[model samples]
Target: MSLAELIDQPEFGHHESPRHQTRRVLLLGNDDRVLLAVARGLGRNGISVDVAWCDPDSPALKSQYVHAFHSVVPYSPHDDQWLDGLHRLVKQYDYDLVIPCNDYAVVPLQLEREKLDPDTHWYLINDDAFQVAFDKAKTSRVASELGINVPRECEITDADVRSGFSNREFSLPDRRSLRFPVYVKPRSSITASDVTNKRSAQRVDSPDALAEYLIHEFPHDGVLIQESFSGVGIGVEILAHQGKVLMQIQHQRLRETIDGGSTYRETIAELPELTEATRKLVQHLNYTGVGMFEFRYNRETGDWVFLEINARFWGSLPLAIAAKANFPFALYELLVKGQTNFHTNHTIGVRCRNLINDLRAFRHQKAEEFDLENLLFGKDYLDFYAPDDWRPQLATLVHFARSVLGKFTRRIGFSV
Candidate 1:
């Protein structure tokens, strides 16, 4: 039987008829691996998936699962063009659901929620909840109130901006109370409008370096000076509806890129303390849809410190799906069918790696010797290498090659 026919059968448990009813989803953001995984998952479940992205050559655009592709201006907090284009696409295609794949897309969509097609549903947290989750300072304060451990941080205020110290070199403050190697990052998540100098996070050894970074790197942006937490990164992903948790999974980071992004991770049993803290935080925020709570677990202290919450689909979504969490399908059922029937029990010890980024991580590690065979066989899953869908992987490789070539040409004072 055909795929549609199978989905329509009584045994398949889908309520919609393949001939008369088909759910449509419009996913925002294009370059992310999570976006491609979401499209493939929803498409296989009989949903007509459409894609919107800023780049014409994004990996998701090459996926066969995408029924249509629309080019929109990249996400920015002040851009109305993207919002207008999204509304037009929803009206044009009569999309049943709209899901933002990243924080850049989520913030604007939440801010302009009422301006879009009201009939169309969104897989997003409420505006108030989004505000709490988006700001790192606010998230830390709230999580701490719920008895969750969070790193101590000091917020840079307008007063600090006016102190003239922002322009002048300054010495370190008293080091008696503060720890060395504190981290400095934006108070809120980075948006597309931020320039290259405005990084997500930077580690500073002394107060002078912190002051220098605040002046040079993020002079205008609000920043948080947080104590550096030493530990392994753990992510607790939860899918919820109106404060009720539907599915949850936990993964431990095994390797990270030079920039501190996860490259290799494995599913693991949920830690009770971490799980309870996540539940309390999500429930307090009344968050809806999919969210991931990141933490730093110190093995010596047995402390799980809250990092921040991603209020949308995460980059490591494929690992969760591969381990049998099936977040994409659960989201579809929750939004379209008014109920979710997926199990949250995922297989532990299943490792997933983003092969390209893992290479970067490996280079950063600089081992004495390399073991090619062990590296190839150790990973249970790769983020973008499915046998059935080859085009996206090919597209990503081409994209990476072109990027490298462009950088090389620029360095050599030539243009191609």
Candidate 2:
């Protein structure tokens, strides 16, 4: 019997034949803005969308768009329970499609893909494409090969770190090519087996700092150390089918924290150079899904460096919908309706802000980063609010209140 058969037997779910029903999709993720965005997008479009994640946030589960919420084991390459649960869920409910919302779901779906039903539709990329896209060093090399300018980067491979591990001596052999301040990032966002691998990239200034980071991180597979530049982060989002670009848009980060996507962003007209390079990159990957190619563009010099790619539905997905790009809807239509014609017209100068994250970002920003006029006027989208769907927003309020109250009480207790 195949590994898939052992993972999903008739005893688990196959025995019960699920009667065919309306198109339904299983979204694999935790409490992410993209999950809520995709859920609401698909649900409002007459497709039943269900939420499945490990240790789901309570407030996010209150979304009215969700048909059901299933908590399952988190995927670690060493474990089969999560995969088993997915197989059981798919077989029992007969999900028409499955979409991964974030890296946790994306990595697992790729590694354990064979254990799931091949005939069933899954929105994931091949391992080859994932390696090139997920690894910053590889991403830079590929971008350079395609005539796209990229920041100088060196990977601290296992070979580079073995001496450090064995004799406390480690350094990049070709470190002279890259300048400081340099940024260190795990080659892949997550490991196949390690659940606690979403370590943020760090900007290091000195050799001591780099060595300290290596001592602490112990990047087993490798870490990409790249030259850092001063510029704004720009996201070039695209939806492609079989390597053909369908539609694309670009957004500029207005207010951001160091580690994650911007809490405040505004859609702008696509830069021609970046868009052309992105098209080439997509065709090179033979990409079949919607993803964002991140870059940092310097206005002063008309220069840009390839950052990385989020090759799945990302944090700013709601912004895409607000701009009329509607990636989730496009994905569903592409697969379910066999529709390929997508109009690439997107409204520019639209801003999106996750109120909660924006509020936090505001606390950490300099005066220049905050935009007063755009905050008050222009096309804007608050990440978690819709007139029709007020329940999730309400849940967010409740959760926020509790969190504040808990923090205050803890402070008081400590003082007393």
Top TM-score: which candidate number?
A: 2
Candidate 2: regions farther than 4 A off: 1-19, 164-177, 368-379
The per-residue C-alpha lDDT of model 1 at residue 75 equals 51
Using lDDT as the measure, which candidate wins? 2
**Please, what is the whole-model Cα lDDT of each candidate in the order they appear?**
0.74, 0.77
Residues 1-416 of candidate 2: C-alpha lDDT, one tens digit per residue: 85333322221112234646677888987646888788878877888777787345544455667677776777867668877778787878787789988887887788777777886788888677888987777887888888887777777877766556443333445535456788888877777776555767888887677777787776787788877877889999988888888889899988887675588888998799889889999999899888899999998998998888889988888888778888888899997778999987889988888877787778876545566566566456877776666556566666677789999999999999
lDDT tens digits by residue: candidate 1, 92-136:
667678888876567667776777777878766788788888777
Model 1: CA > 4 A from native: 1-21, 73-80, 164-176, 191-199, 219-221, 367-375, 402-416
What TM-score, to 2 decimals, does candidate 1 have?
A: 0.86
